[model samples]
Target: MIRPSIPDRSDDPRVDVSLVVNGEKVMRPVSIRMLLSDFLRHELGLTGTHVGCEHGVCGCCTVHIDGKAGRSCLTLAVQANGAEIRTIESVAHQDGALHPIQQAFKECHALQCGFCTPGMVMNILARFEEEEKLDLSDSGIRDMLSGNLCRCTGYINIIAAVRRAAELLGRA
Candidate 1:
């Protein structure tokens, strides 16, 4: 059997991981067992990447890794070495303006308790990146949001927000 490729640290399970987070480079020692979600939340203090269910199925810990959507809860901190990560905190401009997706969500009233919003926004952003544009069709919207889960809003407003973001991005 192949073993994990993580390098061993002398007195602990820590490993060195260097990555770019929200346009800033960061290097930190992370335990082998640490989840990327926990590292983002506890170590880096980027709590915008929320963790609902530890399992990858929930998609609540979604983040952009190397320009693609990934489940931070399912990813190990060591596995993210040398990657570029974008959490919800990065969705806004440095001038404090909302991103198109965030603006759409706000305008469309897509959130209630706001727990699953970050993941939904990140996933939609990644989807726009992957698909280049959205058709805004019902089936297309459903397919785009296949992995994310929301307990409130029933996705009606969310779909509207996705469409509005597509329009704002010139991708509709």
Candidate 2:
């Protein structure tokens, strides 16, 4: 487990947050207004959950909260009390074997700049795990990725990656 490198600020108003993160139990006292993204990145030292639009429109801070994809930047640390949060750090095998979705992203060349990749993977991974069968068609894939925005690519490769990920995960 990666130890948190941030120093605690006791002077700020804080709330006790206890939650399971990437299969590890984390209990911390964080500022009441701290965003879940900030808590994950700063308090717990999970940097995979990126923060892009601070506004939740970019989807760069997506994480699995109680098994559903949610924008971590839009969520408060206190709001996630007792919730199970899964960051992109947990997607791959312990030995560094990439998750199928991550492998698909690489094989399909779905990322450029790689800023939005983690959130994109987390969102797609949730759908892949929850749905029995996903519609891998172009329109369907676009709908699935509607929440995320990528500035580098035209999304042609991203859509293709989603299809490839479906096949790799046996969802197709």
- TM-score, every prediction: 0.91, 0.93
Q: Please write out the lDDT profile of model 1 over residues 17-38, one tens digit for every residue.
A: 9999999999998888888998
Model 2 misplaced regions, further than 4 Å: 1-11
RMSD of candidate 1 to the truth, in angstroms, is: 5.8
Q: Please state every model's RMSD to the true fold in angstroms.
A: 5.8, 4.0
Instruction: Give the lowest summed-lDDT range of ten residues in model 1.
Output: 1-10
Q: How good is model 1 by TM-score?
A: 0.91
Compare the candidates by lDDT and give the number of the best one. Answer: 2
In candidate 2 the C-alpha lDDT for residue 29 amounts to: 84
Candidate 2, residues 36-155, lDDT tens digits: the string is 998998777788898887899999999999999999999999999999999999999999999999999999999999999999999999998888878888998999999999999999
Winning candidate number (TM-score):
2
